[model samples]
Target: MNRKLWTLLIPVVILGLAALVYRQAPRFPQEGSAAVIFARDMRLHHAQAAELSLHLLERPVSKEVRLLAGDILVTQEAQIGQMGGWLDIWGLPFSGRQAPMAGMNRLSMGMATDAQVNSLDTLSPRQAEIQYLRLMIQHHRGGVLMAGQGLKSGVPQVEVLAQAIVNSQTAEISLMAGMLRQRGAAVAVGLPGGSMNGMPMKP
Candidate 1:
């Protein structure tokens, strides 16, 4: 074949392959519905809460703090079960395709990154407590944003769950804020429920 003809054929072949790939891709989130988005996102949120809670449970802490952490673990575990159950009811996997509303959006309730999780797992008891507090604050912030997004997105599928998430996370946010303050650690936020509380934003 002539060089020019070969070049033209390459483009056509590439386009055909691309089309096939696109067609084969899973129809994720089925329009990114609430049932889809919430199940997908909340799984991460709840997992982190459980992680931090489990860490605290394993650590020796002041009675007050330990008690609080214990409560968080139990409550969040129940909530996690509920969300996972929702996925089963919907005939969706516990984690589904990213919804359009949240596909590009990073969930604020997203728990620790792999590195952060690894660090938490490796730390000593005292350090674990501190890191748990910080990572959890970030995780909660992510949750708050998602819950708020769910509420704002008008997706009826996950609205009730999202609202429940907001209510629960808001309360936990306040609790963590107080925990940060009681530790004499100055956080950066002004609101109790806002994750910025008692910590400085990175410059």
Candidate 2:
């Protein structure tokens, strides 16, 4: 009778321990998951925006441009921190080994090329302001596009940040457009459903 009882208890204990282990197992976002991709790509994207803003700040920009640059720098840096935190929590590396934005037009993502980024240093203060506005406007548009894609991530945090990005960057695009007009400059890159120098913006 005692042997029979011990056998039943052994199976029950093993099952309980198995359930506990499963419950405590870490559930991380898989490689190439939407949340992981968004977190990684957005960090890189925000870094460029912050860098541009910082560079603009070093020049003798107008009062309005200075304030705008300051705002962008602060906002983007904070978002970068948040995204980095997400990646850490997901048990992922800061950057994936895969090529960034593989198979996508880096421009469509609103990324500046090495040449464009290098050009920022060559401009006079006035030129810097205008160029900054144009580049940043295009950059914001790209951010909006990427954020729109991220909205489908189905991860609560990613979706929330993506929505916030869409709202803020869309408003900033309009604001920058107005600034461009004030400077008597036109946007070098087109907005959504539009063309920049005859090149249509990707949907």
Candidate 3:
């Protein structure tokens, strides 16, 4: 009887241990990191800007402004599609349950606030230009952060993509900064870590 009991208990113990091990395994791939998160979140963020670009394109402006906004819209929309493609290929969602910007605390540049985005929408053409420039410059900074991190992390596609983001964004940053000074509204560009159009970074 004792021998029979031990035989039954052996299978039960093995099954119990197997269940525990399975439970402890991670749900997502172990490769999950800033590279993946940024791609997903930034795609959504860029989509929002792309929507605005469509609206602004019709509003009218100088050749330079129209060209700039047009380029931004087209480029970012393609980028969004590209990143979304990556997510699709990787079998990942475009966004997780976490807040877009907040979850990116571990990433480089994160998403802009909804309110900051709204302020961009509210400005008149002249005001909008400055706001767009400043906001986009800052937005690119966030992208740079993610891309730089991806480079350091040695994620293949992410590193290559990040370098591109840095190159493009650096140029935009200079352009916007120059434009701000030229307009004598450099002070209007909010300081980093300030209100961010009244929606402060989430804790």
Model 2 C-alpha lDDT versus the unseen true structure: 0.82
Measured by TM-score, how close is model 2 to the native structure? 0.86
Model 3 misplaced regions, further than 4 Å: 1-31, 97-99, 104-115, 120-122, 187-191, 194-203
Q: Tens digit of lDDT per residue, candidate 2, span 123-187?
A: 98888898898888888877877785578888887899999998898888888888888889877
Predicted structure with the largest TM-score when compared to the true one: 2
Error of 1 at 4 (Å): 70
**Which candidate model has the greater lDDT, 2 or 3?**
2
The lDDT of each candidate is: 0.65, 0.82, 0.65
Cα lDDT for residue 48, candidate 1? 73
Judged by lDDT against the true structure, how good is candidate 3?
0.65
Off by over 4 Å in 2: 1-3, 20-26, 188-203
Query: 167, model 1: CA deviation in Å?
Result: 2.0
lDDT of 1 by residue, 1-203 (tens): 89999988999999999999999975433435655676666666676788777866777766766787788788778877876776676567765454323443343334456677677567876666667776666666677666755675455656777887777766776776677777776544422333334463221
A best-first ranking of the candidates according to their TM-score comes to 2, 3, 1
lDDT of 3 by residue, 66-153 (tens): 7877898989888888877877776777766665555444222434566766765576877777766666666666655555555664
lDDT of 3 at 72: 85
In candidate 3, how many Å is residue 46 off? 2.2
